[model samples]
Target chain A: MAEASSPGAPPAGASRGFGRLTIEVRRSVSPQLRIGALAGAIAIGLTISAIALVLAGVPASDLAQEFIVATLFDPTNLKAVFVQAAPLVLVGLSAAMAFRVRFWNLGIEGQMIFGGVGATAVSLAHAGPDSTRLVAMFVAAMLAGAAWAAIPAALKLLMNVNEIISTLLLNYVASDILLHLLYGVWKDQDGFPHSLKYSASELIPDILPGANGGLVIAAAAAALLVVVTARSRAGVYMRFVSASPSVAEALGVPVRPLVFSTVLLSGALAAVAGFVVASSQEGRLTQSFYQGYGVSGVLIGFLARNNPFAAAIVGVLMATLVIAGQNLQVFYGIPQSMVQLIQAVIVMCVAASDFLTVHRLHWAR
Target chain B: MSLPTKAVALAAASAVAWSSVALTASALADVFKIDGPPKVAIILFGPKNDGGWSQAFEEARPELEKIIGAKIPVVEKVPEDSSAITPPAERFIQRGYNVIIGTAFGYSDTFKKLSEEHPKVAFLDASGITNGPNLESFYGRTYESQYLCGMAAAAASKTGKLGFVAANPLPVVNWTINAYEMGAKAINPDATLTVVFTGAWNDPVKERAATTALIDQGADVIGQHVDTPTPQIVAQERGVYGTGHHRDLAEFAPKATQCSSVWTWAKFLGPTLESIKAGTWAPSPYGAFPGIKQGGTDIACCGSAVSEDNKKKILAARQDIIDGKNAIFVGPLADRDGKERIAAGATLSDADLWKMDWFIPGVISQK
Candidate 1:
């Protein structure tokens, strides 16, 4: 209310010179600092969240210490954080690949569900050598994921449909299909509600003896994605198209095929994440097996800016936060929902804080 | 371990004291001892006000606190994942909470790990499958109460078509469905129960939708195994009768809910906590499968809609359960598929009871 009418207006500036506020967007802002503002925003957000906890009668000292103990001080707890973050690595890559071409794929949930269904089907379909079964399951998951992703891509390419709505709504459809199978044909006669467990011969075992195999797969995938994005010609073409569609057109890039392929590839990566989760974490398909890992992966994509290496780091951090928040709620009486609220608040404030930090606010004299 | 062998003279008078049983010598041999006073905490699978399973646990807190002589801290909405379960359990142990009660089947594996990792802390989980030297998993024989609810429901229903919105078609859920049909048959031999499996425990939207579908299909009474009272609410809206689970759901559908299969957790937990305090808490070898007589569950019955004559019959049936004179799952019992499940004059074992996947004669579902 006590500010200048315009950021760069002399007439308004003159009228309210004695009592006015001025905010000017800086000519240039570094990307590094913009990212740094995310950290700053999160720090502020945590401080505010902690204050809220205090106001709600949660002992601040206990909550703080328990959080540190759960996330960092306890070595055993760290293993859990790592285990959870493994599948996110691939899902994050999925979203990152799509974001490279500005494809807002909200249908990763559907892709993951089909990916799980595909692998489950192959495992149940027949018996084979362990390696052969693993490879078959992997390929099937990717094919299903890609096929599911193609629906929205086709919608966008053929009819210029908005992908956000189409992709998001498909998640429910996928859920219904999973329920149908669980309640119908796949229903274990031995266990009416739960589907039959996939045989051990077909499961993807851990690479290291007695260790979670998903972590090894995630690491390899991260390395491969890094090379593909940094050195591959397809990556270069996608970047060029992102930089300027007209230039990409002039340079003979097949725009439709390139976009379609990117979307397919994006879904294939996410499907792998689903496979990892089903094999390593759940070990069997249940009604609630597919949690919101896809949505979380999308958020990781945003925070990591579609960078594989950064996604790995951020995903692990988020896993720790989730694990730590459990201790906070259980031990210190903090609300379990606080963890989700703080995450959303930090993400929201990051953009505003980035802009604010880049611009200068002054009082007109 | 203290009870008279003789059946109580007055059935209705013993209604509040439904199932007071004399503990066997094996149960009296309580082996474990707590390090100090009982500092209890509860880890709930859903929000405290979830209107069902979790709320029943929360509601028992006051009685539990009184029995244990300490305030109990509770953490709600803890997920079933290991990562989500471990930290809170450990935190409770770290904070000197020697007794931890969990409410979820999903917590089975995690509770087993924690029970071993922290030998000094006693861990208990409802509907969980795992146990150790210091851990005991407990679940109720819910069919007993559901049977009572069925009687009340049949009494209230003008039309005998009862519909059920079930969660998972698991054994625990299945038992209730079968026993309900049996009880309904006891009231009116032609009464048939139709079932719809929603496949989730706590999805209200699905529960309500299923309830509406059931009511639309000429079901005048609704039965449920899902974790919400949405079915009862829907029945109330449609002017039909319904039975509730977990708590006295008549609180939600005062006019519609005639009875509820309620968890009398405090009746089981209070004495068990006292045993823990007295340094004689022997965990069950095969988990605590407490029946009506041992205080795992009971029915909240006889709403305004239930007639006095029917209420008398319900009370008599309930007394038979308490006196161990009636065995619900005893044969000659054959499944709907005409397969003999139990031999004539024989009772089903606990293992077989937990695997009751088949329906009885009058229960109709999509199969």
Candidate 2:
């Protein structure tokens, strides 16, 4: 409560001066206020991004054409957006699920890497018939991701190792292992540092003429997540664990198994993201396919406030930004750093809005 | 806690809209032809001012524009992924671009596919392996220029121990390491070259650590095949001599850089575009490998550290390579392991060059 005091407020045990502003923690925040705060943050983020981009010499008309018409309306680019968004949706849901259990799953990229490797392994080994190869690859990817996620979860449970550090450091280990395979055994016939391209039958088939299978898979996953969170007994248990672990433990919730399982599910979902990314977008297990996704997952989780439904929306928005950013670069010759900066601004602004949800500023005497 | 039926509907709408996109990509051209006036564009694999590989193309754009007599716009930071490469490329094509230059090995497959999809557009990629009827991949024989830089490094070295930083143990990188050693040996017979591969192209932190480690190991000069000028920058800070790759490193580290293996894409690309405009272009099925003779690459030679006599020798060697009187990889060559890599009275083939995994004597590396 003392920490919530504003900068100009008097220190503890002193008389507060008139017109001195102070912040107080709210007992509960109304949903309407939460929505209003989010809307305000979005407005600020968009306005700032617009001003920055305009200052950088992008015309307002062109910006609209690029972001709205080109990214959202153009058939080819919209398809590309769908392809890009699929992995983002899965990773976003995964991050949200882990965050619900109060577990910071920074190892999203590592699990993704293992997932891609496992899928590629299935394809390379011809593990199943041509018709069933894609399914086999998907299964392998999920298992691999879960296995990778188990490491950090077990360490956190057994030795109380800080999951944040372990998960973050494991990203490098995953990349190195990926490189090791690419540069060694998995190198293509041309000696490039990428695995052989998957056979067409092993790749994600387009559900519609141009609609990739990955998007459907991602949408279904998001829907499944919504169901699991709202309808399942495990969902209620998870809410208890999220509110307060010790309290939940005293209330007879199986905290350890719940946390572990949630983390594993998160890993599996992230791995599915990798599978889609490789199969649908890259067409092969490439070194950099998993790049930038770990941060994107976390950003989506933050922006969506760990809600699966909101995550799907945020994923589409981010995918739109990516496509539009590419258009801006292609047309205006703006640097990628500027595009990334706009994304950072939006994320930072949205994240800052969290402060308003728990506290209110008031003038005190 | 609410159902996301609205999100599912949105996804379904987006998916339904996708069906409007036609999947009718076919290669119908027997000979590549532009339907309108030549319009050229470039797709860069990194930022325009990345201080290395991509910057070389950015620097070449104006010169290429002059040769083609039209503005050659560029899109930078297009990654090697198909999804990333496609949108910019398709947009350029839609806006009537007839010629597209790509700068990355990763752009190969996409370029090939795009070339087939749009036969009227001529495609070219640097360091790419793929080539087709409407597509050609070209790369400078960097080993030739690096050889000269190696001589310069050896000349500036007080310790007779030189270091090299590279991205990968791939043939392209390994060839540079070998050529650098060969060039160093030409000046100082016993000058040994130690190499460190950072496993990434543009990682400055790793490049800096590798450079510092080499300098600490008594290396007086450094050479690099990595994309960044970090090795040269580190050398300058450490008061050691270095040779640069991609672009002239003297721009970043004037004091310590003895010479730089610089890409002369303008010289190669200008003529290629001219031929392309004249409808006389015939892309090689095996891709183009230009050397100093054709100006694919050359050296920005002789910093203050290199003696005038050594500078003369380096220039003379460059001239010999240009005149086809000398080959960097020739007969009597043996690997560091004392295994014969080149037989007597023979020269290394281009195919062998691309598959080069063995290093010549006096070249040391972890690989």
Candidate 3:
């Protein structure tokens, strides 16, 4: 109670003065220095991208223009990036949630695939243009995703199985299952080894005229996550567990259930992302679908420092890089693999800068 | 709480969900099956919307379906990767497909294996070398059409230089380059043809870059084997003349690019399907030389930029090739190493033509 009312203990003017001083201090840091740092990071990323392009026999000038068009200039390309980023943000949020409880739910990809499969099954079963059916399909998708995640969570809790290996292994199994559905029983009777076209009844209706509605749902989920983390008892307990598990135990926090629930939530969220992509864009599940959303989500979560809002921005940026890469391929003679190199460079720079945030850079000489 | 109890509940719920989904799909299929015609499958390497080889296949699908009186099931944008192709082919075979067509050169091995495994199913592969009792390989002689385009390029060029932009330096592509050079030299003995290989089958950007570089180097006329409108667009922008390969690109840059070596796949597909339906699909390595007479290879309508005299010359050359007055591959053919590949005044055998891997004189290797 005293901690909550600490603002009253300090005079209002003093508190206001402190806040003003903090802002002033931040402002005093040269804007040029900040811009320079960002520019340096971008330059390093471009250098790596350029090297890859040259090796791939594409000219560097073409690759540079592609980066510009993808990130800042083209509205259509920018929208494509945001649409791609939406799913990654959800998956990143899921990972961040699990990380908060020190539970590594790496099987987010498998869970998402299972979720898509479940949603697809529901859509196939209830073929109609009813909103209720769509809602039911989404719910089933979430449940299926949660159930897939729960397997690893339960194994970690009860059988002492390491989640990293289990989750990674499950990805292959899930992929095989998807292949089986596409090639075996669910094969399109029209002779192609592809699933039948999903009807309008199965689709998640668009949020706006152009953008996917899933982005709105993902943003809401992120906002809710932030509010829960900042304002709720469960959120506080999660933070406590993350900081010191022993201390949380002493404070009578139920560690096992917390870990289980958090991981489950993470898996279910990842699943929803998969559900969105499969239902919204593809309308049918393919073996190569969900191309690397899970792994990319892990990178996004790291870049954002597990901040849900920041993860959304980072995911959008990553998506922009991809679209821009394709544009570069179309407009210029730049290879698409250059985008992968840029992503790798960004990840490295972000990781390096994270160290700089905590420690000063020094030269021994 | 307990493991057994949780497992039981999970199994029960999953079973319920699975059964419900199965029942729904079956019911929907039953209702739709009676109304819709039986579906035929068309598996291709790229997207139907890509406006290239896959698009060509897609265009031919509806026509084939119309002839067969069946609803065609098309799997577009399928990857050419081995891991994707093998399983998908097996699945099609298992699903009792009447005819399975693979429209890529890479699917040769897979189709051969599948055809051997499923003898009853007829396999048709485009640009593939696979042949079996139930499988047939079909491809057109693109070099003959390219030769006619080459004559037009040479006759129309202000500069004595012509360019050929190819996807790869493979035998099939090399043959076009060789024929183009031979035809050009036949029209203007001083003409030199520069050839640049982009090392990709569908990269538009590289094709554009190669075209631009050649144009800058004073090559007034160009031809491309790449599958995109980049070359045509590039030529239009630079106020130069170019010829199209594969499908018609006159719509892409109608003013700048005059005439195209159009490859109509329907000519081969119609006969092959008829043969398949009649149970006479043999393991014949059939190569069609569909020139102007067959309408498989024809000079597209020339743009306004092309002069009347140049158009007449192109048409005359087309007639000469169709009437057998001019032989594109009649050799006196020599390899890059100066070895006599085709003896003087002797026509090359089919086996020799299929395994052509050398560049002719005046054609530069960009590898």
Candidate 4:
């Protein structure tokens, strides 16, 4: 674990020059046990999911075999995992960057949805199709996502509202607004709650036909964030703000501005994910445009411990588990609810691992 | 079977035969055929007991199993994405399941691709648009049955004002709403249908809200084109009359469901599977569009709230539909915009019916 310091600036306002006594973290004596604990916790969680499924009537043996096949055997299935991972990587990058500064931006889903709206609106505006349309759509989508992300940021700073609650609840508002438009203003004459299909010139061309070409953006974000977060001054200041807010304030770090930047960038990436998905195969925005990508991004971020690059890797792995695990429902008669249960359990394990991997508690003064 | 049940079953059987009357195509020189024992597998787009669209298939699985003389395996919650649809389909094929049944419009493209890739497997998708030599898409003419339910709604209504809760305004749902209005007019000339599209297939909360909103706005009877019996359930809670889609909503809200446009997949899928097994299966190029006479959708009619006389009239109207004595989207029709759509002597084509975006007179909707 990285030690906390006033990397951003000099400690500004400590009249006594000595701050109040505080507890500090040291590396766990048995640091090696942390891996074992995390792995064990994950195993237990998955085991519980399996046991519940078996009790619900799925054969235990078949479940085991399916997991093996899902994880290793089928090359085609592995490719699909990454295909689904495309949006997750972008959204996860968004979440990872926010988490680095302790912004807790749970509104990634809504931000992504707004992104889709912006892109779709731009596409519908007859922006002359293809590259022109793609560029405009991407810009509009990023701006829309940033705008939505800023809402919660403003609320947090002005009203002292908890972002977790505001961002989570706002997901419903965002979806409802989408529904309103789908059913009302933006509705196509086709009667389905979807937008008009993008003309060939309106869609972003794919780098590879099956793989979403827009994932290049996600990869770029990962690479760029790896630098900005680890090698930049803002990155060091962000660590202080996240580790100790009082320390960051005393160090003359503008916490609100930093938080604003974190959430804004996070929102833009999530919106990029929304654009990639809408343009991927759907060709048009449909009712299920969200497709759990936003929440999955949060999961990937936590699993990757706020590292943008790791978030991209974890995104693909998580997508693999989801894509392969869903088949268990089809082949083995396990319910979709069970798959969701397994995910919930895995997230809990990840959260626990994050705790165990950082910040040791001490009692002696 | 009792007389009504037997009559329905007979009509259902004949409907399948009559529906395929126009469908006469030969398979490609190299086409897939079932081996020794016909093994069947089904892929569902949602949970088995979704209480609507998917449930209709599950409800008829036993009959399908019986007719084919084989046990069928079913997988649920398969998404519309190609990757999600492909793996389970391949797994079933690898396990020696020769015939695959899918239930989703999203499955159309993937089903077509899979049909081409695996020339040995026969694919049947409900509501799918894409088709290959090995794949055939089919959907029932729900409007034909929904029209009858609309009649029931009108007959049950204290006021001539009715409300419709719909999932999207697509052609299939549009035809149903139009027919529903027509049917309502058949009972009461002045009856009006006010439709509220909930913009989803399975969101019960939205359905309930739509239903309640309609009821609040002087709609004595509610008709639903959305999945889930939520509209019917809401109708029952509010002590109002309602009609249902996909399956018999009477099972969910007995007192409220006056009529239901129900899928008789067993009666249809059974014979279709047999045709496939006999090596005479001809996948239609434009897809199979069947009505009451062809066993796509039929009416589960007349709750106690509807008089016996109305029930008899509803049954008679159904018989008329099954015999092709009437055409719903026929000539002399004008959209609400007062533009002539079909000539007096002509009828709407399937393609035209699917792209229907206009409303007829007396039908008010957000679309």
Task: Put down candidate 2 lDDT per residue, B67-155, tens digits, no spaces.
Answer: 87888878888888777888889888877788999998988877987886776688999999999767899999999999999999999
Worst 10 residues of 4 chain A by lDDT: A1-10
Chain B TM-score, all predictions listed:
0.91, 0.91, 0.83, 0.91
Whole-model lDDT per candidate: 0.80, 0.88, 0.70, 0.81
Task: Report the lDDT tens digits of candidate 4 across residue range B57-80.
Answer: 989899989977877878887777
lDDT of 2 by residue, A1-365 (tens): 55747465554445455545567778898988887887788789878988998999988877667767877887778987887889999999999999999999999999999999999999999897998999999999999999999999999999999999999999999999999999999999877788999999888989987678999999999999899998999899889988999999999999999999999999999999999989987789998888888999998988888989889988988887888887887778788898898878877777788787778767656
- How displaced is residue B362 in candidate 2, in Å? 1.3
Tell me the tens digit of each residue's lDDT in model 1 across A38-138: 77877887787677767777777765676566567765566666677777777888888888777899888888888888888887776467658877888
Give the per-residue lDDT of model 4 (tens digit) for A270-301: 99888887776567776666766767888889
By DockQ, who's the top model here?
A: 2
**What clash pairs does model 2 have?**
none
Question: How high is each candidate's TM-score?
Answer: 0.85, 0.91, 0.49, 0.84
The lDDT, on a scale of 0 to 1, for candidate 4 is 0.81
The RMSD of every model to the true structure, in order and in angstroms, is: 9.0, 6.2, 19.6, 9.7
Model 2, runs deviating above 4 Å: A1-40, A352-365, B1-30
**All DockQ scores:** 0.35, 0.54, 0.03, 0.25
The runs of at least 3 residues in candidate 4 whose Cα sits more than 4 Å from the true structure, single-residue gaps closed, are: A1-34, A53-63, A117-144, A154-220, A245-247, A281-284, A354-365, B1-38
Docking class of 2: medium
CAPRI quality of model 3: incorrect
- Per-residue lDDT over B1-367 for candidate 1, one digit per residue giving the tens place of the 0 to 100 score: 1232232233223422322221223342444566889999999999998898999999999999998877888888887765467767777776689999999887776788677566667889999877766789999989999998888878888888989999977789999999998888888888899999987898999998999999999999999999999999999999998999999999999999999999999999998898888888888867898878888999899788889999999999999999998778888999999999989999988889877779998899987
Better of 1 and 2 by TM-score: 2
